[model samples]
Target chain A: MNIIETVSLALRSLRSNNLRTFLSVLGVMVGVGAVISVISVGMSAQAEIARNISDLGTNIVSVLPNFRDSASQSRLLQMMNVGLGREMLEAVPALSSVSAVAQVEATLAVGGDTARATLMGVEPSYSKIIPTDTAFGRWLVIADLSVHSQVIVLSSSIASELFRGIDPVGKQVWVTAGERRRPFVVVGVTEAEEDEPASGAGRQAFIPVTTMVYRLLPARNVSMYLGQTRSASDTDAAVAQLRRFLSLKSVDPDAFEVSSQQALLDAMKKVTIIVTSMLTVIAGISLVVSGLGIMNTLLTAVAERTREIGVRKSLGARNDDIRAQFLVESVVLSSLGGMAGMALGYAGSMAVSKALNWPPAFNWLSVVTAMGFSTLIGLAFGVYPATRASSMDPVTALRCE
Target chain B: MLKLERIVKDYDAGDIHVRALGGIDLHVTRGDYLAIMGPSGSGKSTLMHIMGCLDRPTSGSYLLNGRDVSRMNDAALARIRNREIGFVFQQFNLLPRETLQANVEVPLMYAGLGARQRHRMSADALRRMGILDRAHHRPSEVSGGQRQRAAIARALVNSPSLVLADEPTGNLDSRTGREILDILDSLNSEGVTVIVVTHDSEVGRRARRIINLKDGLIDSVEAAADEHH
Candidate 1:
């Protein structure tokens, strides 16, 4: 008989004993449903984390002098430690740009108004390496470095504190450090922080690093370096290249601690992948258990239909014909469960994503794979029972009570 | 034509090796009606099973239409059963889950006929059995006679050359039994070969030739015209 007719015959027999069929299909449905939903949720969470990391800035990797003794000291990464300097940073061929800033607490006064604020000596590239939003005038340009122009850019808090609603651009600011005083023109105003507002943060101002080195004695810097890669994906390569350059200079790599947003993201993504695979394996086990359920139900069906098998044999059905009929039945049974499970999983992911406020959880490849896998599970588990039914002797089967 | 030469069937009843058929030779011409009669355990059913190609003899050759069916493989024997032979069981062995019309379509399905062709032939068989009105009723929903008629319809659905009936009317009353016997008689008159295996002398008397079996051997042969002549 044609396969279509065989399948139809299988459907009828399955309908005749639907309770057993439903019980078997339920196991597969739950297994496939759990698998699809778990993968979707896992993928959605990874995407969210990557987006958050990219928001902070993807290309920034910073190197700090490993002053292991200063863990209790200041939280600042830029510290005065030996063996890390601008020479090593500039020698790195892969870095698109390198930034070194000198951070020191200096006194600032404008026409009898005084405020204790952090004075940062920075390069023109610092504005690009770190995500800084300009509130008013432009940030420091390359000319600021060439002439050692004492141009200061005030943080929004510092601008609001000193100028109080007045634009600080083109104004003069006096900064005293290391027992010397210098007058610097205010250039621009910058936002408070990159992401959320930090509470109780101090006011700050920026000046060219060259000027800070010349004018401010005891300014212990150009020791910490901040490098930017050509792209976020190149951060690991850039760090490796920077390490190799430091090694060539006879400097111990342990002298500085290296960190990057990309490294943290990669670690987080690795954890997510491991978690997803573990969940998929567990789900696969459940599918195997469900396949056993299918086998049990088919075996029971074969037992109940022993007489019918004999009748068919007496009617001239070959052993192959009997095997095909049962195998077709099993495949139909599993694929039905698979289709239902896919629907359930999609709806499950949708509910989960809605609660989490994530992107839509439509993972088409996983859904298709689960469906095909369930059908294959049916075929694989159907073999033994079909063989048992096919190998039965017609005379004995006909004579069975 | 059907012929059997030195057929023997041995049964292993827990290592005892009971010989069911011992050196039996028989022949039946085309369109002939024959009966093998014996009590239970007399090996009549065993001989009938071999005759219908439902089983293979331990040692011997069985030729149906000049083909050595006894030595054929399982697939080949199944093909022969589909196209050349049919069986009617004592219990009227119809699939209880299916309707009468569907029960009649079983052999045709094995014959690999298409759906429309199977439907047409099954309808024709049911009509000839005079149970077309009950074609949609399941076997349990019909009377014993109607159930036997449905079984008979199924036996003839493939238009096989030989019909093997094992106690075809054993489960029915005398009236219904006679009706079933009339159906078989009409089939024989239409040039179809008929072989019946029964323990009832009255049923054996209806055949053209009757062989009485005893202890796995043919004990007597009753002539066709000698009983009432």
Candidate 2:
């Protein structure tokens, strides 16, 4: 018979035993569904990580004091005294710009309202390194730093809170820490970055580092230095140069830590790969089990249909015809299961994405791979049963009950 | 025309080799109606299987329309079965899940007929068998006589040169058995070669020629009077 007739015949037989067909294909469906859902979640997570890293500025690197262990905490604190200031960082040939920031937790009082906030002391170039744009007024400039101006940039939410629907630019706010009240002029309001954690959005305020050291907190030391490389490709070289320079001046060379967005992304990708592979291996086992299910089901079918096979053989069905019919039945079963599993996986991913507030990503490569694998499983597992059916002796089969 | 010379068939039951058919010779021509009669274990079924090209004899020469098929491979035998032989089993071995029309289309399907043509030919066969009204009914859904008619339609659907029926009415009532025999008689009268294998003397008496097999050899050949036809 033609392929269409053969397939229809197989389908008719399957339909006669609908529940068996469904049960036989369930293993494959669940296996494919698990694989597709896991891959999609991994892809979306990878995309989110990439987006967060890019928001941190691809060419920028942060140098922090490494708090390796509580035993070395005192030594680390002492090593932090070694100056890795803007001039020293900018003098590195690989770096294009540098900014040093020192932060303190303080209460700010503006227009009879008080709110807790992180007060950051930063240079003018800090805006360039971290890449934030002001929603109103202007950013701190070089002259502000040279003059040691007590000028501040408030985030959008803070500006709204302090100004109460009025423009906070050019207004003065009081920053108090332990009864030490200092007045700083709001020069700019920075826009809130999208997709930031709700806790970090409006709690930060930036002021000139010179102003912070001279007026706000004279005892607080620089907390971290942020630098931008001349080119994205030069970030590693810049980080290496800064590390070497800091190590030479510090008593504890291991206390200095430098990291870039690319480094963080690489580390995150490694973890993602491991997680995805582990999930895929688990799904692969299910697929193999499902293949075994197909074999068992087909073998049973062959045994049950021995007399039918005899009748067909007597009616002139060639060995290949019988073999083809069974093979087509198996492949059709698995491919249909794969398609259904894809739909289930997509719906599952969407539900998970909604619950987790993440964007659902549909990975086509995984879909194709899963489908192809299932089809191959059908072919691989269907062979023995189909061959058994085809090779039956007509006389003996006719005698079968 | 068909010819079988010195047909011998053997079966190995463990280490013991049992001979099913020993040195049988037979010839049949177009429009001939013959019956092969024997008790159980007389190798009648083996001879019928060999004649239908379902099994190859241990030593024989079978020629159908001048083509030697004794040494043919499985695929070649299948082709010969498709185009040259039609079989009706006593059990009415129709696919239980298929409608009568589809049951009749089995041989035509293997003959590689197109769907529309196969459908038309199967319908015609069923119509000729006087069961066209029940073409869409499954085998289990039909009566024994109707199911046998469907089986006969299946045998004739391919317009094969030889129609081989093994105890065609073995499971039917006396009336249904007589009806099936009358259909076979009409088919033989219409110039279609027909062979029926049965152990019943009454069934054997309906054919124009009866070959009674004793053990693995033919005991007698008799000409039965065609009184009913």
Candidate 3:
């Protein structure tokens, strides 16, 4: 028989046993639903991480001091433990690719509001290399260093809390050392960064590097330094260049670590992809079971319709016709079940995304993949049953009660 | 024309070799109305099944239209059954889920006709069987005679040259049985070869030729009065 007639007949038979049909289709639906939901969760999480990291500017690299040790040692001893220095900062300019550099200490501060802020000792090129600018005033510069000027730039939070609505630039602020106090002019107030859960370390103050080294923190030392590159992709090469420069200057091969922002992001992506793949594979198990359910159902269907087989055979249906009819019926059922499951999966994933407030990820590839898998299930499951039915002897089938 | 030459069919029922047909030779030309009669286990049904290409003879050649069909494979036999032979089972064998029209349309469906052709042909066949008014009704909704008539319509749907009825009247009351017999008689008169297998001698006496089977062998062949259409 032709496809249309075969399908109609199959549909009629299925409808006659509506409960069985529903039960069979339910297996596929659940399988698809599980797969889609899992994929969506993975996609949404990936997007969220990517957006969060990219928002922090992938070109900006933060240098944290390898300070697992105590901070009370002498300058020479701190230098011995300290990894990076002026050699690294000066070599950044030679890379032609390294846009700017800044060295910072965590000890220097402004009082009554003396807090442990990253006291950056930067050049005027720091503004050119990165995009840092004062919201209310100006930052320290080379001119201040030339005069050994006692000028500093407050972070937006410290300036607001200490200076209290006053533009701190050109205002005198107290910088205290042991048994002595000096007045330093606040030349700038840096802008406060947008708060994010992932980047909570964006607040800091700027000072002339010469002044910071000679005037303040002379007892401790400059340990950590930050670098910026012309492009996000250049960070790796710039880090390599800086590492080579610093190692040559320090004569210590393993003194410091040069980590790039892109490398970190790539690592995160790799880890996430691995997790997502594992999840997808785990969900695939349910799909395979669903396919097996379809096969079992078709097998039972062939057994139940033996006499129907006889009737059709006697009515001029060839063995191939019988085979085609059963095969097509199976495909139709599976494809329809696949479509419904896809719809269910879509809705379920969307609901999960909404309930979790995650970024939505509706993967058409996943849907198509699900459909292909489900169709395969039908084919794999239906083949044996169709072949068995086709192989039935017409005479014996007619004689079957 | 159909011919059975020394047909033999045997089955090994456990330890015993039960013979269903034994050296039974018979012949009938086109448009012949023949009845096969036997008591239970007498092999009359086996003879009908072999005649309809539903079964193969063990050691004999059965010819249809001058071709040996006994040695044909199952698929080839099914093809001949589809195009050249039509069957009416004792149980009517109507697909209960299908409407009368759809039931009659099955053979034409197997003919690979398009939807329009199958529908038209089925309607025409149902009309000839005088059940056109109930074409949309399911077999469960129709009477026994109507169901048998639907079966006859389905059998003729492909316009087969021969109709095989295996105890066609067995499931019906006397009136419905007579109604079905009359339809078969009329179809034979219209140049369709008709073979009816029955255990009732009363039914067998209605055919133009009666072949009696006993102990798997042909016991007798007697000519009877021609059935009037």
Comparison by TM-score, 2 against 3, better one: 2
Q: Output the better candidate (1/3) by TM-score.
A: 3
* Model 1 chain A: lowest-lDDT 10 consecutive positions: A74-83
Interface RMSD (Cα, Å) for model 3: 1.3
How much is B10 displaced in model 3, in angstroms?
A: 3.2
lDDT of 3 by residue, A94-200 (tens): 33322223344353344445544566766665665556778866766668867667887877776776767866778777765444455778878777766512212
Order of the predicted models by TM-score, top scorer first: 2, 3, 1
Q: Write the per-residue lDDT of candidate 1 for residues B101-200, one digit (tens) a residue.
A: 9989888888989989999999999999999999999999999999999999999999899999999889999999989988988899899999999987
Q: Write the per-residue lDDT of candidate 2 for residues B1-229, one digit (tens) a residue.
A: 8899999999998999999988899999888989999888999999999999999999989888888888999999999988888899999999999999999998998999899999999999999999999999999999999999999999998888899999998999999999999999888888899999999888898888999888788888999986865
Estimate TM-scores for all models.
Answer: 0.82, 0.91, 0.85
TM-score of 3: 0.85
Candidate 2's C-alpha runs over 4 A off are A67-83, A88-90, A110-113, A147-149, A166-183, A195-202, A211-220, A240-255, B15-17, B225-229
Q: What is the lDDT of residue A97 in candidate 2?
A: 79
Candidate 1 wrongly placed segments (more than 4 Å): A56-58, A64-89, A100-127, A135-225, A232-237, A248-250, A259-268, B224-229
Candidate 3: list runs displaced more than 4 Å.
Answer: A59-86, A89-134, A139-219, A250-252, A355-358, B12-17, B226-229
DockQ values, each candidate: 0.67, 0.81, 0.74
